[model samples]
Target chain A: MTDRILAVVTLNMDIVAGGAPIFFARNQEEQVKMARYLARTLDAMVHDLENGVYIIVKH
Target chain B: MEHYLGTIIAGTLAGTVARMVMLRLDYRQYPGYPHGYLSHLSLGFIASALGAVAIPAILKPDYTAVTFLALAASQFREIRGIERKTLEHLDENELVKRGSDYIEGIARTFEARNYLAMACALLTGIAYELGRAPAAIIMALLSIIFVRTFMAGETIGDICEVVPAKLWFKDSILMVENIGFINIGLKEIREKITAEGLAVLITPKNADARATIHDLGQRQAMAHTVTVLLGTKKDVDLPEFTPLARIDPDSGAVGLYAVPVERDIDALILAVKRTPVLESARSRPLKTQAGRMAAR
Candidate 1:
């Protein structure tokens, strides 16, 4: 039962601590919605682990 | 025994050749990789295995000759397609830089493809005598094993998402845009790294909100941020740039400064090193519906 996850990151990464609040223009959900979009455009990996969203920057 | 040997050899060789050709084509488009040979070797093995399995199965299970020929012709399109697709990406150096290094490392180093190829081979081996269902079962087990083994170092992190909306959850703590209400939401990583000069990959696009990024704080244990997006300049705010928090949208990276944030070092490097090793793995994911569209 050995599970090995191969993570091949393709760009310069800087882990921004999750849960760090970002004040958006709309509502809270709107923030997540914006974050989610930016995350994708940035080609980020938004992981759900350790009780947070692990947004990986895929170059 | 003879048949088994033939199958294995065929599979291994096939995996090797296919991967090599692909690698070669990829390398030609983007060259000068310091540690790419190892990747080539591993992929070669996997390709060899794939070839071994598929080629032999129809080799004459009951008139394997005709079947093999037909299969070859049928598969030619697939092979060509793979090549064509690869070529298209090859030209996109920025996209594939990290991909090449990573595939060479992860796909080749970890034998990720080999396990897949071998599992498939085993299924094929057994299925010839049994029915396809039995083979599918074996393949499933192989896949499970592969998954588990592959997940060993996986930090329970984000799953691959296709369209992570540009918005946060309604009740999220992290949001860059101004939300009238405050909800506790998970943090997000935002920003882009544009390389300028040697050892100078800088994040030009800055974010003003923590909600946009899960930045490493000075005191957090989760702050092992390994790769700092630095270029020829340290941290400078350009006139055209808007401030993302206190960080001045700087680009002239001539100096170095400790990233004033927190996150894991290994994982940070793993997360940011978009050298292809990071990109392919980072991009290859399974995202939820709401996440992919960006509309939220």
Candidate 2:
């Protein structure tokens, strides 16, 4: 299966902007929660970009 | 026809026994069911009958009967295709997949075993014709031993050293020994992995082995085998728990990470060591002059 970014969850909205749907969270806890939800729903993996941004990728 | 009875029976028995010996239900767990055994044993019997009849046919000066061996060979080729297709279908649903290279190796082995059974039958028939029951029995025993030894391929332990490796988190990234694994975004998931995860460092014994483990299919096969034996904590949606084998480019060593349901370190090490070295992944670069010089 081709790896593709399904969604992006970030505390800093300025860091992520693209074709993929992005979710803006107020804090780190909310970002992780949103990323986990999207990953489980999409059957994907949450990879940390290490800049308060987590991209849910289907691998 | 009456005089040939002893030879035919001896040959067919030896061949069937050889097939039975080769058909083992190991950790790989393919053909573990009763139906799988029945079909394979039936095919083995047919192969043996063909081999047994050849001697008597030749003794009767019926040279045309020898040509049927060509027909039997084509049939065995079909067995390889069938095995490949079956494994490929099953791989789709697996959390840890046995890659195409591993599937092809298994299919080739199944085809070769039929030929081995045929050879054992032919040798037994020859022995029976030459020296009756005693010689045939001796020959049968020897042929079975030869097939067992010859068909047994090298395992990971034969070409590499498997050692327990520490799993640690480097910031948000998972690390097995010095090799960086996947990036964990969730703190809870990271904590779970750090608490339950197991890791191993596989160091190749030589240049040839280094090339073998460098193959992506070989690494997948290693992960699949270990997951199958040890039971992975991964699920359909829990892709984070999926086992991974990543190579260390500088040392040519492989670091494998997994969170098993069993959580036994010794069993994990044994499972990794027992994984078969895939034929397609095997490379003998050390045999060449350029490789020899590069190794130094």
Candidate 3:
């Protein structure tokens, strides 16, 4: 994995990237799963930027 | 009988004096008060006795006494272990925890100091046996000075320059010297930062210093030192306002942002300059030819 930003997702009742809604997770567990799935699919790693925001990247 | 008395007195006194000379209450107040000094002094005496007796024991044709020096050496190793455990336990309660590297360095220093004391006593004993009491006293002074110089380590000021920089807000983002520091969306928090927060720019003199400053642990140590000297305005809930260091991607200059209770920039600069280069994060690029050329 390389240090390259895949997407910047924010939690606002759902996960949003680039001001567009991507996925709707009911709880923290679902959010984690979605993050992992997106990371694995994009060949990136997920990092929590806190304040309910996560950045997926490949390094 | 007079000769034996001279050796014992000279050796033991030299070791004890060395220990006392080295003892200091620094930033990490480990051996703090009366109790701590009491224990160290007693151990110093024992180490002194062991080293002092070495010369006389060999001269008296009693080889068994020398074996005790080996026993003393083992005990000193255990002392290192004890120091590490003590510091590690105390670190949990510290606001700015000393990293494992710093703790390990301290523990090694404590052990080494005891060994130096033993060596000092031994040297004084030899000098007394060679040229009487005056020679022994002279040797003790020389050894103490040698140890003092050897133990003195480098501070941050030797490797870099620290100067105050104004904090800037561009589109709700905090910037220091054109470096994107942090996002400050809240108007009140941004206002407070603009009013009181202090920013300092640290520029490394060479590649090695740049590598050292880039280490996250080193930056944390610098922030911790500043907080200890000036006091931080951070609370448990106020994570956003926590002291942060941002490095310029191109130039490798570090920018420190902190809102301290004491708003004295001069004191902050002095504190940062005096911060010891953390042993854990120290970079030594000058050791390699390619690295040396790049640094030059």
Please give the DockQ score of every candidate, comma-separated: 0.04, 0.87, 0.06
- Candidate 1 C-alpha lDDT tens digits along B149-223: 553332212321111111223343322222211222234221221111111122222121111222222101111
DockQ of 3: 0.06
User: How does chain A of every candidate compare to the true chain A by TM-score?
Assistant: 0.35, 0.94, 0.63
Model 1: how far residue B7 lies from native, Å: 1.6
Off by over 4 Å in 1: A1-59, B21-111, B117-295
Model 3 chain B — which ten-residue stretch has the worst lDDT?
B24-33
Clashes of each: 120, 0, 4
Task: Compute the interface RMSD for candidate 3.
Answer: 11.5
Best by TM-score: 2
Which one wins by TM-score: 1 or 2? 2
1 against 2, candidate with superior DockQ: 2
Classify candidate 2 by CAPRI docking class: high
